[model samples]
Target: MPEADGAGEQVGVGPWSGGSPPDDPRYDPELLAHGDRRNVVDRYRYWTVEAIRADLDARRPPDRHLHVAIENWAHDLNIGSVVRTANAFNAAGVHIVGRRRWNRRGAMVTDRYLHLHHHPDPAAFAAWAAHADDGARLPVVGVDNVPGSVPLEGRELPARCVLLLGQESSGLTPEAQAACDVVVHITQHGSTRSLNAGAAAAVAMHSWALQHA
Candidate 1:
């Protein structure tokens, strides 16, 4: 049973208390012996990292799973948040363009359960998308409030596609924009010129999920 704090909110389950350990391979013996306080859903409380990833892969829809790509040239702090959001949406994969290393603190360690890819630059990323093993040529949809971009609110995102995002200080680079099949912007009615990269990703992913998930 899980122990509650002084506020009466349950934290995490205690170690396995039954007479004999279950025969499931998915459950980790170490985690079963010790409490699982990791920030995972109830279904994965005692599962190993590999088991959780395999389960997520099994649950992913073959034809409709979405992918997200982000340019990491500037080591943007928002990338972690975007990765975390992608995990929540069960994105098929995440592509990191420009730089391979990124700050992972904001992701809350969710990246451990996601399939991450690294591309040296936008051109390489575009090339990989064109010849992905799945054989479906995924359209690169750039999410930025730039000129000539269509509104994203009612747009029908591709059932299988990569939602590409740019850096925080500058929007999409020339190469990235050129590689995009189409560009869409989240309509804004507030005083801010644009949204934070993480917030923008969440809205764009939610928009895609609404249409195809």
Candidate 2:
């Protein structure tokens, strides 16, 4: 296995474009027919769908952390973007709460590397997380810039916690907010009501890594 930098990170492929005609039977037909081209690294290009799935399954970490997104209504274009960010961060898993369908355009096919779980609602995600770990019951942390949110920079983050993100526009639902053990805020200088859901998730995940990767 190739090692990442001291920061516990690995670099993706560059200067490689999606090649190899998808005429091969092993690759995902959907991806082949559609434009799978994106800024993604070269390692994934033209790879068989089953091959990629198997590879991802083998690479999954047993002790890795979790990240969740509350889809709520059909307004989660940020979900795919968040998934892409999660892939860049190499999160243990991604939990999607609410609508099953999301905009894959933003994911840019990085979803191939992520282990995704689905929860019907926020309450369901909370319940699963509560018992997901034997005694630990992975801590649920919400990321938002709301008025009462705690500063993420100074706070201690859990090693195996689940970072929860709300929908792109509405933010977290009441049920999701109530389920979080702590609500964290990402400090910003620019005047805005809130940050983009995908951007917020990336910042939160990186913050967690800085504290306790």
Candidate 3:
């Protein structure tokens, strides 16, 4: 059980189950006995994690196949947040290029619900995206604020495309930039030079969702 806060509300809490366990197989026996506290939807309360994943997989909307890729050379802490955002948007999958290991603290455990693929280098990831099994041959769109980049606003993103982002500090490497079919930048009027990579990813994903999903 989570500890109560100053206001007497449980911290990091989720909905609790009623007296008896559900008859459905999807519900976890243990969770039914001891209240469910996992961060999940109301319909998934008391349900096993695998069961929830299976349900999401079964009902995934057709044509909702946008992929997200991130360069992880620095073991970027932003990767986890990006993964969480990807889960929120129901991305097809997430591709990690450069390093396999990344900081997961910012993900808030959302990575468990997302499909993740890893590639040792950017070229390998680009190749896989180009010749995916489904043959969607998704266009590799790079998200960065580099000069000569086109504004993302009003630009019609591909229905099946991969949004590749770079590390927080370094932005995109030359190789990664070379792999991009089209590079787009998010317009900002604020004083900040750029948004955090994770935040940028969320905006980009939402942009795609608005047009494609």
Candidate 4:
């Protein structure tokens, strides 16, 4: 397993050493000629971006039907981290409500591998969810610890549902919460008021994966 590295530490493999590169079309000639230093799995070391995305799409199981929605009204930095986690979990798609342009630094370029959508506001997002292209009206499950919320533990998330999260500082705007079919919250033993948006997203995604993935 490749260990996570900090700045200045070498990552990924060097250029191919063989006389001729593989004839496979999926392989990127430039990467093969030079080196594959992108932070990717070993299987995708020299693969082109399009090839990697296509492979991932082909291998995705139908049962892996979870989607993620983030409220980007504030251009929250946590949005990028949430996107990276969504990619890790192989979410069906990611929806950005409110602002289209978000801080992507925390994503580390993982967004390129996932399908993304943008909505003008929570109402627009909710409308789309009600009549998605697939014909399945996916439930919008909000993750926040506001009033009248239920604990997420042991909860059975819908197989084809969207996990919605709000901005880091002000979680789940009234409009966003109103758009949700059901609101769930993570149980905490610590004294902290609430979990960070990124951490909360990971926990909610993991919980859904545990139940359905």
Alpha carbon deviation, residue 80, candidate 4 (Å): 0.9
- C-alpha displacement of 95 in model 4, angstroms? 1.0
Decreasing TM-score order of the candidates = 4, 1, 3, 2
Clashing pairs in 1: none
The candidate maximizing TM-score is: 4
Alpha-carbon lDDT of model 1: 0.89
Task: Give a tens-digit lDDT track for model 2, residues 147-190.
Answer: 57898887888877888888777787788888889889888888
For model 1, residues 154-199, the per-residue Cα lDDT tens digits are: 7889888999999987988889998899999999999999999999
Model 4 sits at a Cα RMSD from the real structure of: 2.6
lDDT of 1 at 47: 91
Evaluation by TM-score, superior candidate among 2 and 3:
3
Looking at model 3, which ten-residue stretch has the lowest summed lDDT? 10-19
Clashes of each: 0, 0, 0, 0
TM-score of 2: 0.73
- Which stretches of candidate 3 lie above 4 Å from their native place? 1-19
| Cα shift from native, residue 148, model 1 (Å) | 1.1
lDDT of 3 by residue, 35-121 (tens): 665556677777777887787676666565688999999968999889989888878788999989999877767678778899999
